[model samples]
Target chain A: MEGPPEIEKREFGVGEYGRKIARRHLSFEDERKLNEFLRTEAPFYISYSVGYFKFPSATPMENKVLLGSDLVFEFDADEVGLLSERDVWMCDSCGEAGFGYRLKCPKCGSSVRIEIFPDPEREEKLKEMVDALVKDFLLGDFGFGREDVSVNFSGNRGYHIHVRSEAVYELDKSARIELVEYVTGQAIEPQYMFGGVVPCGKDTPFLCVEGPSPSSAGWPGRMARSVLNALERGDRDLLLRAGLKRKDVDALLANRERYTGLIGRGRWPAPKMFPLEVWANIARLTAPLSGHAIDTQTSADIHRLIRLPDTIHGTTGLVARRVKDLSSFNPYRDAVALPSKEVTVRVRIAPEFELGKRTFGPFRDEILQLPLYVAYYLIGRGVAEWSLDSTE
Target chain B: MEVFYEVPFLAVLEKRKDLLPENPSNPPESVLKAASTHLRSILYGKSRPKPVHPSVFFTEANLVAFSPSSFLWERFARHYALLAVPAFERREEILLRHYPPSEVLSLKEFLSVQRPFPELKLYHLEVSGGKVYLGRRAPLFQASLLYRDILRWISERVRNIVVSGSLDDLRETAQRVLAPPSGRKRGYPHIQRLLNVTGLPDGRKRVLFYWLIPYWVTVEGKTPEEVLELANEWISRQGGAKIYSSWILSEAENVRSKGIKPWSVRKVEQIDPELVKLLRGMGAL
Candidate 1:
């Protein structure tokens, strides 16, 4: 298996991997020095922010002045509960970690970090979200060509999509906000996008229009597709299960011809007899699922410092590898940066996780000889420690 | 409140009618001409008009004809500097020349002009006899008054006379100042004052509170802490409403670091008690 080149064993302080990397390798005195460092290290991740450092060096104070930062969007599988089936989440505060999706630390009410166990389903979902963001939003909406965009596996639980277009480089906070809003469909007025009124018989109230136009792009197209899927299902109970009301479902079924005709024309006209609430509910159901769930704060924050591409993720011991082609990129395979040398570790707690092609156990308070990457991953996540005798 | 100030230049010129050349064409025109000439003499040292002070003298006619000495010029410039329409066309040129170009007033520049006045008082008892003065009813008329008042107050306090402009021009200047270079909007004075006092930037402040009828009411205290306490008490009485105090404090810090006027509380009601408390803690307000 392709992996990082072997390095001589060196003792590093606990929780000092980032600092060690910074001290030994980071020399950001000038552009040439920084570029040389970046090239030499070829870090899995590389982040750059102009005017971010107070002292203008690799080692900057915590309170460094950040004037502005390049735009970043993180799609973490943990955030979307991709590893909810079998994962351990530990709270940094109060030391509460266990199997399953724990949003907050039960002991101290702090957010828990997920020790993600790779699941194909979750990984697929993460890929789908990233693909949608890049293809649909970035390329389609923002007019960014494939060359203008770069995708990278975040090396832990997510994907990071970076746009290096000259067009987006100088966008201010408000402009970024506008871009985020477009991606998130924040200011999309359903009434304006989908609402259409058609006159029915005088006895029957006028019908209100809903659903997307086939020609219309983005949410409207996705909405149309979703509506068509529901129509194709043609099962009332299934529609109801999808959060449509019984009355609306019945109305839709009764006027299937009219509805499908409208759908063909890229619209849905509901009988005025149906409550506006029902139409709204139906609209909600038909709207596209949020595949482009971006962190609004990161996008809106013009001065945000983000993870550098090609840098090692300290928590996962995996490389944040940049992907030229997103379609065939598998983070598990491509982003595995650590060497496969086996190492013994005493795991305090670990849920079932997959690394490379093999699966590891749901270990608890057990000393096990594991692959170096797996052992380091556990150690890095603070779920396991190096076996005392083995280290000596 | 309807406010009327006795035209001090007109009053001074009326007082010094004996100083004028005999058979002056128009009394008001003669006063303005004399005042302009006097201002030019002081500024250019009795030299003929050159492009010496383009801001103060837009035309050669203004430099040649209007010299009424420094005293008369000071009195005239105080009120007529902001006259909506100058009584004479030459007067308009002088008024326009006295103020900086509207395009130059960035947020930073505007904020710099806002310093020297710790608090903006709406009705200065001495200036308006405690009754409110009404200027031409516009969106930014009150703000223009506040701007003029702050300039006048600052100039007097510093023993230097800063140039003033008309309500409409001030409004435009504020619009240019507060508006982003790209997405410009109509500017309001009251909103600008609130932004300055609260230490919020132009972008954030414009969205808060309705600009019509100033919502921030005045409170008198010997110290800012005392004023803040009073403001806090008033807010607490409003029933457990959480104001965005932390956000405001962060913004205040940002403004301070930019070397702009630090936060101050001009109106108690517009501020959240928590913000007042934070400001007091930081020694900002």
Candidate 2:
């Protein structure tokens, strides 16, 4: 039993007046309650520690065998020797826990591709622990005065104590890992972190608020399919023919709104089918075709139709734009003018748009009064039809 | 309104010094259609000017080329009707009333408006056959520069090129034509085909040239047959119809054998929903 921290904490009664508390750190009882609740009710599983290992852990299999069930399956690790000493893995799947690694989830069969990092709160605790240790090392061992060590609570799990003193950055791999191992509750050979322990941490949050339950989040895929079939095949009477009541449809609509309402608030970044930007883009592209109102059927279609941008860089600054002030003036528009004949030699300052900044001309009045459409046409056409730099 | 018949519709509209008195009756579909048709015919050379050498034709042509109507309808008209125009038209009174001159606005200041308009006003200007009120009226030549830059912008954005070297030769030629050399002879059909090069004094010629580059090089796919079809259609009604040489056809044939043509131009007998879905999947839209 831990007392409340030295900082302020807030408690609230959430849905159904259920009590929820948030603070700098969870008490043991709080952790137990939250963990139990999540384990029992959450559709997705949660994970704790994450790191690369040279070889797969035989402990899981050993435990499975001890339990005497066919629950465990084994697959060769990516490399045979010290195979676990590789990339990190985080499981959100529902499957019998085993020693073998899986790229595809065993339970729901979803792709296991995930962005994982150290846990935040636990990482913070580790950081505080590390700071104490580093201070002891500097004063007691090195005989140097204590200095400010910045701490990071990796957004996922685990903490990193960055010692800013001049001596720390110059530390060799063996020495650095020694310091880290002294702080963190793990022991590893210098050979393991030979490449040098690059101090990286999860910089983003991981917890996701649960959206609407499956049945409520748009007519279930099955119902939506039936509706689509009816529309495609001209079976307008299918709603009545199938005996699906308006109440059932209404239930689906309500569920969709609940899910969308949560999604629209900008909480989760990369949800299974609802990455915020992808979600918004989908809604935007489909909204017009969905007609004025967004019904369950349309919502279902929107979910199915929207896709991530093809290029990774396509939406790099998308979020920034969303947050940017929209009432500003346009620099591009302000640059307009009728090109004169004196500036006949039109010099496209980085015409290929390769130049980060575009400056039109030093035309000695030789420029032509190009219409907006035609100018864009040339620029566009040039990009499409011509290569500024030819591989040929 | 019909005064735009011989002129590039965009050229006339670009020179707008005054915000026309709010006449709701103007900008009718029929007017737009007629303007677009004439503009297209002249640009495509469907309405040729007069007998002249290819050089003379290119030099003398007032209109650029290509009908933007099809493009307007296909790409943005619906978006405008449903999203852009209506959204901004809500403030139409303010926009029309407060329309400032270009001189009052600077490039950086104008680009700053990208936040709210999100390229909406820019796109409107790109597609607008009617007058675009850009603050106060600047000189036609000055405004034409703006148009040229806008075309360059839209082209770059629409294409979304990743690598510098991947640009097609046609696009290269268009880019190259932005400035003509001192000794450059006029009416070179191949050169005129380049968007940047314009021997013609008419701003419309530049617009038409750029428009055709996409249709011929990107969308219609680089077959000589398609290019010839477009070129022939363009020159059919023009008085200078004789000036259109076999160069367009010959270039198409040459480009076709190389098999480097754009997929957008390919003729498709059928475009089923599945194809649309596939394209959507590819993020082509």
By DockQ, who's the top model here? 1
Q: How accurate is chain B of model 2, given as a TM-score from 0 to 1?
A: 0.24
- Interface RMSD score of each model: 22.5, 30.9
lDDT of 1 by residue, A57-167 (tens): 323334444333445677777664455667788888887778888779888999988777777767777787777677766776455667767777877778777775555
Q: What is the TM-score of chain B in candidate 1?
A: 0.22
The C-alpha stretches of model 1 lying farther than 4 A from their native spots are A1-32, A35-46, A50-69, A90-97, A103-113, A194-212, A235-244, A274-292, B1-285
Going through the candidates in order, the fraction of native interface contacts each one reproduces equals 0.00, 0.00
RMSD of 2: 36.6
Report the C-alpha displacement of residue A55, candidate 1, in angstroms.
10
- For candidate 1, write residues B69-138 as lDDT tens digits: 2333333443445442333344434334433222222211222332322121111100111112211111
The CAPRI classification for model 1 reads as incorrect
Judge the docking of candidate 2 as incorrect, acceptable, medium or high.
Answer: incorrect
